[model samples]
Target: MSPYLKLLFYLSGISFAVSFEIDYSNPDVVEYDSNSQIEKTEKVDLRVYYCSFCGGCVYFHTKQLDPTLKKIGSYIDLKNYPYGLTTRYKKHGKIYFDCAHGPAECHGNKLHACAIDILKNTTQSEFYNSCMMNSTWGGEGSSDKDAINCGKLMRIDSKPIIECANSERGDAIMEYYGIETDKVTNPKNKHMPLILLNGKEFNRAKDLMKTICQTLTKPPPECKSYF
Candidate 1:
């Protein structure tokens, strides 16, 4: 991995560790005498692979996943990757492609990637939610202005994000997402909003909340109904 990617991983790990407080007093916790062996259950990482221009992906995220995510909060670590669905075209020895949502969607993807890099955790979510909610998916036109306006509303400096979107670094990040997306085993997994729980592919988008609750080693109070 590149140094930048390494940094992103390191920062994400730190964020996950610091975001939640573990409860050792849970009733399920086994009290161990000095001679008794103890078992460890690691926290699950929930990664979302999505495309900026996919209408279903956008709707699912904003309407379904976001609310549950907020409810679950620190119970799981969340990672969002923006993958483009267009195939690259070679012309005059240069490679280019038009996104399903148009060039504006490509720009929006770059902007989202840059926001994640520039901000951490909740701030990243703030920008992402704003952009997704205001984006022009399933409709006409681009979401460039909406994304920019959202950044401004969040008090983030939009200049760096804009510059990153146009830089080689942004291209590298997008390529990384593409490489990751291609590794999925499912033939129909080329579509957006591919969700993974604990590094395992998770289908059944409608049962997302239940699936997440089931996977938790020590689910929070909000997950009681699902249990």
Candidate 2:
């Protein structure tokens, strides 16, 4: 097993099992509008699955895309899913997740999910960027307070997100993401961030923009400028 998966097993103290199965035939994808309002004649779907506390994920996927997003935003509909790199366990007859970066990261994931629920697409993007800016990989980077702080920085009311983070809804979303991660076949891969463009996995973070540009059937003006 990979070090990450080993860590998971160590934390959970349970053998890996397919606890449940989901309909992988249809994956959840969310479409977002660009920062610009320019109507595009052609568009492609871009999906990113990420763990907030993964340093590599934050550095390569979140921080690196801000500039590229400005150019390709209109040509691509971006959807980001927060995948928690955590293990599930039963404690006192209650199930709990042990996040790699601790409870703060888990809380941050819930915050992001709640933001998606209450904020507009553009706002969601902004909120994600802000939260990521506060994140650290492989450790307890951003705390629950930091998540709320980021929301406030974006002028988003943090109450709803905080409430959601503390509710059963938050637990369900995290569990759902855990299931999604399991769908990936790589035995060594136990963490985030994973990217998929139109149902195809894009493994390398450095090649993300190039891959997206190449995947576009009807190349936008931005594609020409990108390459």
For TM-score, the strongest prediction is 1
In model 2, which regions exceed 4 Å deviation? 1-41, 90-93, 120-132, 135-141
- Kindly list the per-residue Cα lDDT of model 2 for residues 1-227, writing each as its tens digit: 75334433432335333111111111121134643365644556666667667777656543445445645666666666675466777678665787777777777676666666556675255334444334322234345565554454445576776787788877776677667666763656555667666777667545666767887777667668556
Give lDDT for model 1.
0.57
Off by over 4 Å in 1: 1-42, 89-95, 126-130, 136-142
In model 1, state the lDDT of residue 33: 17
Measured against the true structure, the TM-scores of the candidates, in listed sequence, are 0.69, 0.69
* Residue pairs with backbone atoms closer than 3 Å in model 2 (clashes): 55-137
